[model samples]
Target: MEIRKATEKDVREITTIYNEGIEDRIATLETEVKTDKYVMEWLFQREKRYLVIVMEENSHIVGWASINPYSHRCAYRGVGELSIYIKREYRGKGLGQNLLLALEKNGQQNEFYKFVLFTFSFNDLGQGLYRKMGYRKVGVFEKQGIRDGEHVDVMIMEKLLG
Candidate 1:
C-alpha cells in the first residue's frame, strides 16, 4: 500500500469511505450521509488548505486520513483536528495506522505543531489506534452525542508534534 496526498478527483471514493464511517455510527456523530456535491466542495477547499492523504493498494482507495482546521483563532493556527477512516473490509489490517502516520508526518512538515481528535468512548479500536500513535487523552465530553437513543461519551485527545 502507498500513502499519498488526495486530489479533488478522489472525492467520490473519499465520500464512499466517509459514508461507511457514518453508517458504522461508531466513528462519527454525523448522521447525514454525504452527497457528491457536498463532498466535492469540501475536497476542493481542503485540497488547497489542509493535509488530506489516501492509501491505495492495487490501485484502489482503501483508506484515508486528514487534518482539519481546529479553530479559526490565531492562537490555534498550529493545531489540527485529525480524522481517519478505513474501508470496512480494510479495518484491523494496519492500513488505518499507516494513513494516520502519513497524515501526521505531512502535517508536521507543513508546520502544524499539534494534532487533536475526538472519538466516541465506545470506539475501542479507534482509541487504541490513537494511543498507539502517541496521542494523549486530554479531556472528555460526557454524554456528548446521542445515537440510536443512547448517550455516547466523546473522548478528546491531543498529540504535540516533535
Candidate 2:
C-alpha cells in the first residue's frame, strides 16, 4: 500500500469510505451520506495546515486520514483534530495505523503540537487502535450526540506530538 497526499481525484473514494463509516454508525456522529461536491469542499476548502491524505493499494483508495483545526481561536492553533476512515472490508488490517502515522507527521510539519479525536464510547476496535498508537483516553462525554434516535456517549483521545 502507498500513502500519499490526497488530491481531488481521490474525493470520490474518500466520500465512499466516509459514507461507509456513517452507514456502519461506528466512526462519526454524522448520519447523512455525503456527496462528492460536499466532500470536495471539505477536503480542499481549508487552510494549508488542515490536510487530507489517502492510502492506496492496487490503485484503489482503501482509507484516508486528515487533520482539522481544533478551534478557530488563536490559542488553539497548535491543536489539530483527527479524522480517519477505512473501507469496511479494510478495517483492522493495520491500514488506519499507517494513515495515522502519516497524519501525525504531517501535523507536526504543519506546526501542530497535539492531536485530538472523538470516537463512540462503544467503539472498542477504534479505541484499541488509538490506545495502541499512544493516544491517551481523556474522558467520555455522556449523550454527546444522537445516533439512530438514541443519545450516544463519545470518548475523547489525544496524543502530544513532537
Question: Which portions of model 2 show Cα errors greater than 4 Å?
Answer: none
TM-score of candidate 2 on Cα atoms, chains taken together: 0.98
Cα lDDT tens digits, model 1, 7-94, are 7778889999999999989799899999988987877776344878889888788988888999988898889998899999989888
**Candidate 2 on 33-102: residue-level lDDT in tens?**
9999999999878998898999999999999999998899999999999999999999989898999999
* The candidate that achieves the highest lDDT relative to the unseen native structure: 2
lDDT of 2 at 120: 92
| Weakest 10 consecutive residues of candidate 2 by summed lDDT | 43-52
Model 1 is weakest, by summed lDDT over 10 consecutive residues, at 42-51
Best by TM-score: 2
Assess each prediction's global lDDT (C-alpha) against the native. Answer: 0.87, 0.94
